[model samples]
Target: MTVTRTLALLLALIAAAAFAPIGPARAQSEGPLRIEITEGVIEPMPFAIAPFIAADSSAEDYTGRITRVIANDLASTGLFREIGRDAHIGRVTSLDAPIQYADWRAINAQALIAGRASVSGGRITLGFRLFDVVSGQQMGQGLEFAGDVDDWRRMAHKIADEVYSRITGEEGYFDTRIVFVAETGPAENRTKRIAIMDQDGANLSYLTDGSALVFAPRFSPTGRRILFTSYDSGFPRIVLLDITTMRRQIIGEQEGTMTFAPRFSPDGDTVVYSLSVGGTTDLYSLDLTNGQRRQLTNAPSIATAPSFSPDGRRIVFESDRSGSSQLYIMPAGGGEAERISFGQGRYGTPVWSPRGDLIAFTKQHEGRFHIGVMRVDGSEERLLTASFLDEGPTWAPNGRVIMFTRQNAGGDPALYSVDISGRNLRRVPTETAASDPAWSPSLP
Candidate 1:
C-alpha cells in the first residue's frame, strides 16, 4: 500500500480499537468535551498523558523532551489539568497497545493521550492518539509527522495543537512564534534589539545586534518578515527585515520625517504606519510592491499606532484629535473616521483581532494602565489586565489570548499573557527584559 493509504488504514484500526463500550464510572462525561471562555471561575478538566514510547533506541533521547513539551503546552492554557504519571495504573509501551480504560477512569482522567517517537536516517517521526475516556473512543484520527530531527519540538507542538483542537473545537496557537523587543542594561539607558522565539520561549535568537534601538516588532502574515521601528539614524524610522536573510531596508523614508508603529496589512503587500512630519503625525500606507505611498489620514492631531482589520478594508488607530489619546477607525483608502473608544481612560495601540470581531488596546486611567478589548463598534468594553504599566497588547493567532508588556513601579519591563476572559495571567519567560510582543501565525 502507498504510504498515505497505509497511514489512513492504521488510523482506521486505531479508531476501531477505541470503540469499546464505555464504563459506568465514566458515563458522566459522555457529552462533547469543551471549555467555555467566561468570566466565572473554571475547574480545569483532568487529562492524562502516557509517556511516549520510544520505538527505537535512537528515539529514546527525544521521547521525554517531546512529552514534556506537549504536557507543558496543554497545561499552560489552564483549561486542561494533567494527571501525574505516578498515578497511572500502567504505561503505554507501543503505538497499537490497548488502552486500559478502567485504570484511566479510576484516576478520573477524562481525556488520555498516547504517543510514540522513532528516529532514523536523520529524521524524526511522531505519532499520537487522543482518547475520550468517558466514551471509550478516539477523539479524532491518529496523526503522525516526520521531519528533521532538529524540528522535533515543532512536531510536538503540532501534536499538542491537534489534541487541543480536538477537545476545544477551536484552532490551536501553540505551533507559532513570537517577535519582541529584548532589552538590556539599566532602565534609563537600555539597549533594545529585535528578537524571536518559540511560543514557549525556546529557540531564542536575536535579529538585531542592539547597535541601534528597535521597538514594536510586528510579524508579517507569513512569519517570514518583520516590521519594526529602528533608531539607527538618530530618528525613529520604520524598517522591514527579512527573517531568512536578515536583510533590512527603510520604508516610507522621507527627508525630515519620522515613522513608527508599523504593521503589515493582512495580505502583506502593504504597510500602514504613523508618519510624523513637522511635529504632526498622521497615518500612511506604503505599497511594498510598487513603492507607492498613500496618506490614509490628514489631521492636525497626532495619529499613530495604526493596525489593519483582517479584511484589509479598514484601519483602526490611536489618535489624539479629541485632545486626549483615543481610538478611531477609518477606511483603508483614507476617508471619514469614527471614534471607537469612549471610556474613562485614554486608549492607544489599538489592534484589531484576527477574527475581525473585536479590537484590543492599551488604556491608561487614574494612575494605572490596562489591556482591554471592545467590540468593533466600541461597546462592551472589558479590561483584561491592570498593572503599574501595561501596554502594547497583541493577540494570539487564534484571538483567544493577548500578550503585552507589563512593568511594575521601579521594576524592569517583561512580557505577560492573559486569556481574553482574564484568567490564567502568566509571565512569559525571556532572557532579558522583553516588550512589544507580536505573535506570528501558525507555521506552515
Candidate 2:
C-alpha cells in the first residue's frame, strides 16, 4: 500500500477505537472496578505506591529514589492520584511479599503498585506489579527490567506506560522528547537553532551553529532527520539535517525560488514544503531517497505552511486563493481544493492534528493573533489563546493539548500550552525567548 493509504487506514482504525460506541460490558463496570476513567472527565484513579524494597546496600539507597520517579510520572499525567506517603496504611517492601489489600482500600486507594530493586556490578533490576485494591487480585503478571543505574528515568516512564495502558486503554506519552527552534534576540534579527530536550524541557542541546536564520524545524516521524528552512544566503531555502551526524544539505534548492515551511511525511521518507517561484507560492513534495520532486499545488495566490494528514493522503495548508489566507485541504498529489475555514479573521499555518481529528491554525483579527482549532470540515472552531502576537499552534502528542508561541504585551515571546478544552494554560520555560514551536509525534 502507499504510505498515505497506510496512514489513512491506521488513523481510521485509531479514530474508530477512540470514538466507537462503548459496549455495556465495558462501561465502567460499577463498584470495585479498581481503575478506569469514566467519560472524558478523568476521575483520578487512587493508587498506592510504597517505596520499593532493596536487595542490597546499593539497591537500598536507590529504592526510594526510583519509586519517587514512578510516582511523579503517574501523578503528572493528572489521571492517577498518588496516596500520600503518610496516608499509605500499607507499606509494601517487596514484590514477592503479600500486599495488604484491605489496608490499601482503607486508605481509599483503588490500585496498588509494588516493586523490588536490586543492584550488582553497576546494573539495576526492577520488578514491579499492579494489583486491584478492593478485589485483592493481581491485574497483570509482574514485569521485570534491567538497565544501567543511570537509566532510572526510563524505567519509571516504562512503568507509567504499562500502568496507563492497563487502566486507560490509551498509549502514554511520558517517554517522548520535543525538538524545537530555540530563539532569542529581536524578532527581525532572531537567533534561532535546532534544540532538543525531554518533553518537559530538560537536557537541552543545540544542533546548529546559530549563525543563520532558521524557521520551523520539524522532526521526521522517526526523529532521525530535521526538516526546516534557513536564510543562510539571505534567501530562504529548504534544508534537511541529520540529527545524529549534524551533516546538512539543501533540499529542493531550485533556482530563483524561496522555499520554507517544511514537514516530513508520516512515513518520514518524504518532505512536503512550500516553494515560491517568482511571487507565487505553492506546495511541493520531495522524495528523500532519490531527490525526486512533485508539485502538489499550482495557484497564483500564496500557498504556504503545508502539513500532511496523518495518513498522508491529503494536505492541509494556508492559502489566500479565496482572497484572505484560509485553511484548505487537497489531495497529496494535487487536485481540487476544498476550503475548510470560513471564519471572520485571516487564518494561516493550518496543521493537521496528530490524531487526525482537527486542524490547528493561527488567526488574526482585531489587531491580535489567536491560536485556534477546528474540525477538518471547518466546524466547531474554537480559539485556545489570544495575545499580542500568538501564532504557531503545535499539537501535543496525544492531540489533547496545543503548544504555541506567545508574545507578551511587550512582544517577549515564550512557549505556552493550553488544553484543547481551553484550560490548564501554563508557560513552558526555556533558556531563552522562544517561538515557532513544533511538537513531535508520540515517541516509541
Candidate 3:
C-alpha cells in the first residue's frame, strides 16, 4: 500500500472480526447456565457483582476498585449487564460468608460474583468466585490471584477472565496489551510515537520518542519484540525493538531503499514487509535467526500489508494488481495469489485473525472509510465501523473484539473497539491520540 491514498488506506482498517456475539441465558434453574458463542441473540446476561470483601481492614479501597474493574471488564464485552449495587437485596460482608442466591435471583440476577481481597507485605492476594444465581450453584472453581500491590488491575482482569471463561467457554482477553502509534500536535504536523498500554488504555509507556514518524507497530507473538516502520534514518525502514530492554535494531538493510509495513511471522523469527524500488513495491521476508532473505511477492502491482495466518500456512495481503487496491491471499511460502475482495470499495491493510478464520481490512468507498472483516475465503464481509477515517484493525487475543483507529477531519485519531457482532462500540481510553494499534497476546 502507498501512502498518498491507496497506501494510506492500507494503514487504516483496524477492525474485522467475523464474530456473532455469544448469548448468555439462564436455561433452567439447575441446568448449566452457559453461553454458546456461535449463534444467538445478544441480550447481555444479567449479573450482580458484590463489592469484594476486605479480608483485612486495610484492603477496603482495593476491594472496591477491584470489583469495579471486574464489572467494567464484563460490561465492556456487552455480554453481561452488571446489576447495580443499590439494586441488590443482600450484601456480602465476609470473605467466607454464603451468598444469598435467592435474593440475587429475586432481583433477576442470573449470575452472581463475589470476591475477597487482602493487602499484606506490599502484595495483594485476590480470590473470586462466580455463581449461577438462578441455579444456586458455583459455576466453576474459584480463582485466586496474587501479585504486587500495583498490579491490582491485572488481578481483577484475571478474575474477570475466570468468570468470563466459565460462562462463555471462550478464552478471556482482559489481560492484554495494545501497542500503537501515539499521536500529538495537529493533523498537519502530527508527531507520532510508539506507545504501549493495557487493553483498557492503562499503564501507558512510550516506546519511542516522537523525533521520527512511526507506523504499524506490531507485537511479536511472544510480545517480547516489536516490529514497526520508522523514519529515524530519514527514510522509512523496518526496525525491531526489544520490549524489556528498549533497544532497537534496523533490519533488512539495503544501500538505499524503502522498507516498511513490517509484521512478525507466526514463529516470530521472521518478518514480512514491503520494500519499495523505483515505482513499485513488493513483499519480502527477513529471517531474524539466520539473516536469510526471501522475496515473497514480485508483482509489478503494488503489494503491501502482508499478515501471516496463525498456522503460518497462508498469508493475507493488500494489493493493487486488479487495477485497484483489493485483498489477496497467497501461500505463506509465497506463490501465485488469488484476489479475495470483490466489493465496490478499495480494500487494504488485511490482517488475519488469530483464530485463523477471518481477515480484517480497511475499505474506502463512496468517499467514506470503514473497518470491516471477511471470511478467510473473502465471504461474509461485514463492516463494523464507518467514519471519516477508520483503519488498522487488530484483534483481541481471543479474536472476540477488534480495535482500530477512528479519525475525524482535522482532528487527531483515537483508538476505538467494537465487538465482532458489530455491537458495543467504544473508545479505548488512550491518554493521547493513537492509531495503528496492534493488540498483544495475553501476558504470561
Best by lDDT: 1
User: What C-alpha lDDT do the candidate models reach, one value each?
Assistant: 0.88, 0.77, 0.84
Q: How close is candidate 2 to the true structure, as a TM-score?
A: 0.85
TM-score (C-alpha, index-matched) for candidate 1: 0.93
Question: What value does the lDDT take at residue 68 in candidate 3?
Answer: 89
The order by descending lDDT is 1, 3, 2
Model 2 lDDT on a 0 to 1 scale:
0.77
Q: Which stretches of candidate 2 lie over 4 Å from their true place?
A: 1-43, 60-65, 186-188
Better of 2 and 3 by TM-score: 3
The alpha-carbon lDDT assigned to residue 162 of candidate 1 equals: 73
- lDDT of each residue in 1-444, candidate 1, tens digit only: 122443453344333221222122222223576666667889998999999999999999999999999999999999999998999996777767678788889999989999988898888878888888877776666767776788889878978887887677667789899999999998888999999999999999999999998899999998999999999999999899999998999998887999998999999999998899988999999999999999988899999999999999999999999999999999998999999999998999999999999999999999999999999999999999999999999999889999999999999899999998888999999999999999998666
Model 2 residue 421 CA deviation (Å) reads 3.2
Task: RMSD for all candidates, in order, please.
Answer: 5.5, 6.8, 8.9
Ranking under TM-score, best-scoring first? Answer: 1, 3, 2
Candidate 1 — which residues are off by over 4 angstroms?
A: 1-31
lDDT of 2 by residue, 1-444 (tens): 122332343344233221111112222222354344332455677888877889899998788877887787677656778998898778886666778788998999888888888888877777777777878877655666666777666666666666665666555665566677888777778789877776666667888778998878888886678888899888998889887898899988888899899988898888889999878999999998888999998899899998989998999999999899999999888889999999898999888998899999999999999989999999999988888898888887777668888888876778887767665677876898877777766554
User: lDDT: which is higher, 1 or 3?
Assistant: 1
